[model samples]
Target: MTQIATIIGGGVIGGGWAARFLLAGWDVRVFDPDPEAQRKIGEVLDNARAALPGLYDMPMPAEGALSFHDRLEDAVQGASWIQESVPERLDLKHRVYRDIQAVCDPAAVIGSSTSGFKPSQLQEGATRAEQIVVCHPFNPVYLLPLIEVVGTPANAQMVDGVADTLRGIGMFPLLVRKEIDAHIADRFLEAVWREALWLVKDDIATTEEIDEAIRMGFGLRWAQMGLFETFRIAGGEAGMRHFIDQFGPCLSWPWTRLMDVPEMTDALAQKIADQSDAQSGQHSIRELERHRDANLVGMLRTLKARDWGAGAVLKGHDKTLQAAGRIADTLSDIADPARPVLTVDRAVPLDWTDYNGHMNEARYLQAFGDATDRLMQIVGCTPEYIANGGSYFTAETHIRHLDEVRAGARIRIETQVLSGAGKTMHLFHTMYEGDRALATGEHMLIHVSLETRRASVPAPQVAEPLARLAKAHDSLPRPEGAGAAIGKR
Candidate 1:
């Protein structure tokens, strides 16, 4: 059954929620009184469509239906998740919740995207207070995975359910133990914002200079290893204790005006605005958004490669998506064992392309390598099996690049088990863009014992399936370029 998510406000955050849900295969019903809500959300969706799918090596689920509704009741009619992203006004939020709970399914989760409001505060004077939880997500909800889920003990169960729902949509839900002002991440952000404002007001650094300081230095470390862990590394061989002993006293040195608030007088505001305009005003908002999305996609892809931090979340989401059978052209389904099995079906990520504006040659091997890994998993050489003692090690590879393909192009790889017996497994993978054959890779692999790091006979569980697939594919015609040499036609 298709899940439904109703978005109550179609501004930046609301549109991001809509895009995230829609891209994750949830039907989205948006209710915003703003006349240009549709156009605004449409633009956000356009950016989302171009960026999110590239983050994964597997295809995403088919996009769900998107509709606009004038009335809040109509939008919440059948939604399992209702996200309220209105302005941060407590009374206005209470009113929205009252209307939502009156018509929404009592069991349905009603999440508020309020950055500062506590769940307890939002729950006050509500029809069903337990149904409301604060699910504060970062900007560009489609890409960034962090979501601070805050709830009282009375609504603990609902908060758990919200976390599960968030995971289903490829988001990281950091459940806040106790309701507090601004939650966890925002408190840190507020501190930074406060200091940044003071810096600009005191002529210490311009906005651009401040941004440069972040992107050029600690921001990279923070992206992979967060604050505490990064600081622990800073301790060198001794760890966190040593580092804290050295730097902790500096906290009281009055280096920052964190407790002081710079009055946002018109003159100050204009000075900051003028500086910002000079720094990045040449590009339109849409262009800036596209640049942001592209840069995020590239950085996130790097994280995904290492399976660390936010990248681990993305990797787990890919597994969940694959397990749910939300893949392109039923790539996981082997309808006929007598032919090549469709293994990899995904879009070329922006980072996969080269300076020549085409998919890099090395990425071809990577895609084919993924296809080989898929085939191994299908034949029972899974992670658990490998972790126990055995796995395949590719001995040799030959790749033929038949055509040039660009980024964002959808590619599929079908693998044929050429020889699977004893300690050897040979595979031929053909990569395609629609019906056009773009590349072919032939790989010879040796089954090995992880302990000894040498060739070994396959376990019965793996051997049986391998034999079956090899026999099943034996009758198929040989692939055209299977055994061709490097310079041969």
Candidate 2:
């Protein structure tokens, strides 16, 4: 079945939604009146393309097509899901919803990406209003996994399906139990925003200071464990109740004016704009975005190792990705019996380059590791199978660097299964940029019982595929330096 998603606006949030759904293999139709909406969305998609795939070890679903529609009716015609992200105006939203209601598929679920409006507010005077829910997302939605799903009880049940769809695109759907003026995350953010504004208005701190306070402190903790868990840890093993009991009284102090609101005069807005520029004027927005993305990717990847918070979500999703075989085109699926398998074809990003403006030594190993992982999948030692405790562990690896690969150089790895008849599987990989071979690696791996953490013969399921692949490669002539590369013949 072809799943279709519709976006009724092409602003940041809408563009992000388009990227998310489109990348997840849903045909996406977008409608917006702005002349530059497509261009803007294109830019977002570019950023998304560069950042998203790096987050996963497994290949993502082949990208679904994205199209822009001039008419709202055209956009929502075949949509299984319709998301409205127009400017935050009740009348405008209601109009868009009406337009959508007339043309949208009868079974399509409706979501409005409004930060200020509750689901009840958005559903007002709209046809099939019971299906309208507020599906608020943060900025850079493609990177951030959180989405706050809010709806009235009567219509809230429909949101579960919406949550499932969001999950398919690697988003974490946070259900807001009750519809309120600003859903949960924003409410917390608004409180912090108010405090920050006061800090600025009072001349107590600069915008940079406030941001540093976040990125340096609670922000790091929140990214992984969130508030309650951090606080629970602060309780020194006594847990939540004890922590709350200990800190309850401090909450009564005048440390913050949570109820206070600052008047936003033109002068105040100018002050903020000026302060923001002063804080980060050195870097262009794109540069900053790339910097932010690099840090986030590094942080998230590290967290993946520990299986905590956002990392946990990413890790879980990668399993779903591997299980689905979402990418479809694996090296083995397209290999020729006459040639080595083309297991990896990717560009070395700027971040992967070293100080010499060439691909770093460790990255060469990582790329080969990615190729090895793909090989593991072809031979049935997939993430799921490995979870059951049988897989190959590298016992020895010898790499020869013949040339340097610079940043943004598209590289490929062709692998030959040298031998795979027993507990030991020997493989060879050569990295290339076009016809130029840059490096070669000879790897010797031993089948391991993950439960025992030692070498053991693999089960019939894995062994059979490994043997088949080895047999297929047995006739290929061995490349030069086979004996010198890894020593053992």
Candidate 1: lDDT of 37? 98
Report the Cα lDDT for residue 21, model 2: 89
Model 1 per-residue lDDT at 389 = 98
Measured by C-alpha RMSD in angstroms, how accurate is candidate 2?
3.9
lDDT of each: 0.90, 0.83
Q: Residues 336-434, candidate 1: write the lDDT tens digits.
A: 888789888888887788999799988998899999888988888989999999999998899998999887788889899888999999899999999
Write out the backbone clash pairs for model 1.
none
Q: For candidate 2, lDDT tens digit of each residue in 1-489?
A: 879999888988999899888888899999988999999999888877777776776657778999998878888887888888999989988888887888777788888889989888887887787879888998788778889998886685687888888888898999988778888888889999999998988899989999999999999999898888899998887788899999999998999987888998888788888999999999987779777876887787778879988888889898888677523243356546446777776556556777787778898888988888777787778888898988899988888899989754667788889988778888899989899999998888999888988889988777887788788888889887675847565
Residue 47 CA displacement from its true place in model 1, Å: 1.9
What's model 1's overall lDDT?
A: 0.90
TM-score list, all predictions: 0.90, 0.86
Model 1, C-alpha of 227: deviation from truth (Å): 1.9
Mark the 10 consecutive residues where model 2 has the least summed lDDT: 326-335
